[model samples]
Target: MTTLMEKAHAGVVTSEIKRVAASEEVNAETVRKLLADGFLVIPKNINSKSEPIGIGKLMRTKINANVGTSRDNVDIETEVEKARTAEKYGADTIMDLSTGGDLDLIRRRIMDAVSIPVGSVPIYQAAGESIGNMSSDDMFNAVRKHANDGIDFVTVHAGVTQSSFERLKRSDRILDVVSRGGAFTISWMKHNCMENPFYSEYDYLLEMAREYELTLSLGDGMRPGCINDASDRAKFEEFIILGELVKRAREAGVQTLVEGPGHVPIDEIGLSVTAMKHLTGNAPLYLLGPLVTDIAPGYDHITAAMGGAVAGMHGADFLCMTTPSEHLALPDVADIREGTIVTRIAAHAADLTKEGVREKAREADRRMAVARRELNWNRQFGCAIDSEKAKMIHARSRNADTCSMCGELCSIKMMREVMKK
Candidate 1:
């Protein structure tokens, strides 16, 4: 029952390692070394038939799109469409954060709808019954159920312990907590006057993870909800505990990813990303928006993209997409597609400045530049993030050599004639 990390440590280059190596364009041995050192993780459960996705140092920063059913809106077909749309646009992964209506069925349906690795917050399922009714066993059982159902990874807020709670009480913040899982953990602890089961019984959780080779995503329960609350004591306290848990999970040979903040200002995003990586021993960091500004409701996706680019440049490994409906209501399929494409643009922008993947990232831009110079509209469209949209936009111009704005006065065309003279 050796986990993927254990296999990597044993120097066994399994098929997963090979596939990730080929996809990431890194050597298989290098991938194994990084995984063994806990700097990389491939979130593929033993029962999942989904493709392996590498998230960590040396790999391109990946984007994750969340699709699920809320209590008020439980349309399974729409959720499934959202999942498909997310994947089609460029989401490296999918996380089903559905908190309402036949969760198990919704989860299975979403998983069946896509071939990419899928993750979930098991607490969402466990806390559905009622925070008061949720026992420590119920928490652990929910995790096991998702793993058994072939969830590639699960977000566990194991850092929301009694000690972290003390720090939260001491802080004076605008938004105390914005994470649903975090709130649930705190409420459950308050109800039973007990520590979080995920934190208290982490070893038992590790045992189950090893059995299923589950990649545990340590959720950032105390993540800041606003710019003012950035880098608070409560958040760091949780990171300290998560760092220790990360070391233990590595020892137990379970792959792990550490989640990061939600609404950090643009300036603090760098420090926040750096500190989390340092504290967690460079475990792959999966970040929510860490949105630069809190004011944009309809355009939060763009806000998050700005923050994500900076965070990715600063070493954040994975980004969770923030849709246009982030603060509004349930996102439709169009919202999912736009969010996915926008976040991908951010990820690619980050890769251009990133260390390991900079050359590859720049290569794509170089190709586009060459096509532009040659007035190759088709090639430019081919290189675009949204080829269909690019083609559609250009189709309106009718001038194939130059766009509507510049037309016959295009600099690229003008320069070519000037050079010939």
Candidate 2:
């Protein structure tokens, strides 16, 4: 069985590529060429039996919603509801980061509930079990189990090597290590006086990913935690290793996506995207928030959306949403909706920078302008990404001919009336 990359290399267009192209509004041949060249990835494991989603160059920006239970919360039904809600609100992909309850059952239930591609970080399970006793074999087994369970992709932090840890130690930053998986691996490696299992045995992991046709999202284990830590030695060092691993994975017939920073300032976001693209040879760059600010705890979703919009516009292929629950606790249904919708807004905003995406957005905006001029509040609300929110907000102002904020000063209506004379 040819992997997507292998099939692209062989000049055969896979069904996944066609489906992705159609969804992304790109030429099938274009997606094929990008896949063949390792510049794009369509992460749909052959065993997944889920709808394929594309992430990479020249495609519309994609958003991924992280849903799952932590040690504190472990209700499978609630997690499943979150998954369904994520899909409903427009998450192109979902990652099950459940570290609590029956891990396998949670994953299976989430996968069963949604048709979108589902991903998982296997190390979470490995670390969850023994906490301190998990060996390299334990980590490997966890990965194999996820693959066998048909996870579309697995985020393997195969970049944090012994040498990288040395750099991390030598160069301190505001946030030493922001990634949960990275912290787990680094602690284990330091305690065991050994290298990270995922780093040391990456090929073995790649072979497993290949057998199941799973894409490896090279996790940014040393991602910056604050603006002060953005793009420091530890972050770049891990990226260098990730670049090498990406080449190795593609060579071995496994798809790969490169994960990026945690918290980055507005000014540094574009550079981070460019650096990751250059380092990973343009393999789909999946970024987490690159959260522009550290101060907004309850409103990290907005911060993430702001950063996600910039990252996507600059070159980040996939945006991982930071829910309102981020830095606090697990999100409920409302948080899920808020996070997904905000991230979608970011994705669409970024899409405007793409070739035809602006035209689409401009068309919508034009319709909005016309709607306001005609006092068509229904059309104005209908054109909104969150129509329910728009309707509610509009209704709260007594359904005024003009929005409450600018009621008597409605620009379009005023301008039209002035022009009529």
Q: Which candidate number maximizes lDDT?
A: 1
lDDT (tens digit, per residue) of candidate 1 on 1-421 = 8778888999999999999999989999999999999999999999998999899999999999999999999999999999999999999999999998999999999999999999999999988768998878888899999999999999999999999999999999889988999999999998899888899889999999999989999999999998888899999999999999999999999999999989888888889999999999999999987689999999999999999999999999999999999989989899999999999999999999987899999999999999999999999989999999998888889785899988888999999888895
Where is model 1 more than 4 Å wrong at Cα? none
Clashes of each: 1, 0
Residue range 1-421, candidate 2, lDDT tens digits: 6677888989988898999889878889998998888778888877788998778887778899999998888899999999999999899999999999999999999999999999999999998666589888988999989989989999988898899899999986867997888988898988899988888878898878878888899999999888888889888988889999988988887889999988989998888888888988888999998799999999999999999999988888799988998989889978999999999999888887865456766677789878877988899888888898988877878636877787787787788888995
In candidate 2, stretches whose alpha carbon ends up further than 4 angstroms from where it belongs are none
CA-lDDT, candidates in order: 0.94, 0.88
